[model samples]
Target: MNRRVKEGTYKGKKFNAICHFFGYQARGSLPSKFDCDYAYVLGHVCYHILAAGLNGYMATITNLRNPVNKWRCGAAPITAMMTVRRWSQNPGTASIGKPAIHPATVDLKGKAYELLRQNATKFLLDDIYRNPGPLQFDGPGADSKAVTLCVEDQDYMGRIKKLQEYLDKIRTIVKPGCSQEVLKAALSVMASVTEVLSVMSSSPINGQSSL
Candidate 1:
């Protein structure tokens, strides 16, 4: 067990202690539907990789907003995901240790961090506690999902709306009597808009601020 010194003194004695731990309970609890689905998909991807005799690779499945059938699956070499770390045992040693998988860290520039930063001042003073409740298998809460998924879906819908508006304008102006030059210009504009939308849709949804 690990112990740490707690700040401040109780009756002029420094309080050194092992903190209360909740990790065991958290790990033992039933996983949410999102977690279950994610694990299931990853398992299938791993099976495929093994069947193909692949090694030193990690399976990945993205596009969580879509159905599992529409999710993209691929593998990346484990080495590509790793970073070199200095050995703690020999602080002065250089280039003597092996690389390890890079740990995931909170992105300071991400939407989640931005949201927290924006409201941090108020949060520090207020004892605010939000209970999301337990994960649901049915009813209204069943449809509740991650903010990232919701934001991506909203962005996609917004793009569709813009496309529809463009189409409506084209329909009004491009008729049987319209000139070839005008039709060509309209087609050019449509193509440009389509390209932009395609790029936006294909871009990774990295917890965008629009959430």
Candidate 2:
């Protein structure tokens, strides 16, 4: 049997397989809590993306680590996330490839990596694995987010909201009845902010020129 397997004589059928080992961790876990909620929210976002007529755009949900209500649904151009790749197929021969979106991977220098490193010792020797058994439909565990997301500190939507609030506050402070000095200061600040934003908006991303 070992010789037959080693000599490539064991072929009967060939098929691709996808392992769902972790997906089966929960009892009766065909559709786990997080998977169900995330998929449903993405479907909702897709509807809005289509309604907005953003062709060739990706549906994005920022502030994922927050509650579902706080999630911001929007669409971004798929091209914006793409980059051109130049590769060498053979010695001294180069090929320029079309723009493509790269898959995301764990950043070794990121906070998520730090968190894993911090827990490495405990994970290796303490025999302290956590199994959040069964999907929870309500209460505590239902609102939990992935550890990586929680540590990444990527609350873009939240930051956007804060910026909007600051803008509104500035407008209120520099209203029509304000002093001349205050008005001038505000105008100068606004001019600088606009200039900066214009440059940033026009800048190329990932070696692709903006359209």
Candidate 3:
């Protein structure tokens, strides 16, 4: 073990810099309902992923807002989630950096963030805190989901499947024998949709969108 070279005020210390220990603050022992349930389900998913001999894959559980029985489990390749970054020392010059997985950041524009921002001051200053006690596995609060999950319609894969269903329906409805009005309406709507999607598609390029 290394000892302090000289204990008096240390070397090159900033006059205004300070540090504080946070171990005692926010140290309630109870786990939240969402954390308990999410971990339990993901544990099972991880076991199945292992039993299937998957390598370089991350276990996933979706539809957290739904009942536990309704949740979907799957595994995704680690490579598919990585982003290849480009490093540039100068504005017009660049070099390729290694691919890495970046943690998902909260969207400041998202509804959950907006809700938290609106209540943040009150939450900090008001004596309105309520403890949820220990995590519940069966009764009242057991099925509770995260605030973000409740605020955002985050059934992503479910929405994708629904979109595919709609596309299939459209295909069936817009065949050669369809009415002229039906064809015209589909053509108009699809043209507008395609134009908007094309504009969005052209505006981005870094790596695959985060799941």
Error of 1 at 38 (Å): 0.7
lDDT of every predicted structure (CA atoms)? 0.68, 0.76, 0.76
Error of 3 at 168 (Å): 1.9
Tens digits of per-residue lDDT for model 1, 38-122: 8988999899999999998888866677655666777777776555554445666653445665567777877767777888998
Best candidate (score: TM-score): 3
TM-score of each: 0.49, 0.62, 0.66
How well does candidate 3 score on lDDT at residue 196? 99
Q: Which ten residues in a row have the lowest lDDT in candidate 3?
A: 202-211
Superposed by TM-score, candidate 3 places the C-alpha of residue 153 at a distance from the truth, in angstroms, of 1.8
Candidate 3: tens digits of C-alpha lDDT, residues 1-211:
0134256545653447469987877685666767777888889889998899989998887777777777777888897766656566888886657666855887899999999999999989987534345566677767666678878877767887899999999999999999999999999999999999987654424543322
Query: Which scores higher on lDDT, 1 or 3?
Result: 3
Sliding window of 10 residues with minimal summed lDDT for model 1: 202-211
Report the CA-based lDDT of candidate 2 relative to the real structure. 0.76
List residue ranges in candidate 3 displaced over 4 A: 1-30, 51-53, 88-94, 130-132, 184-211
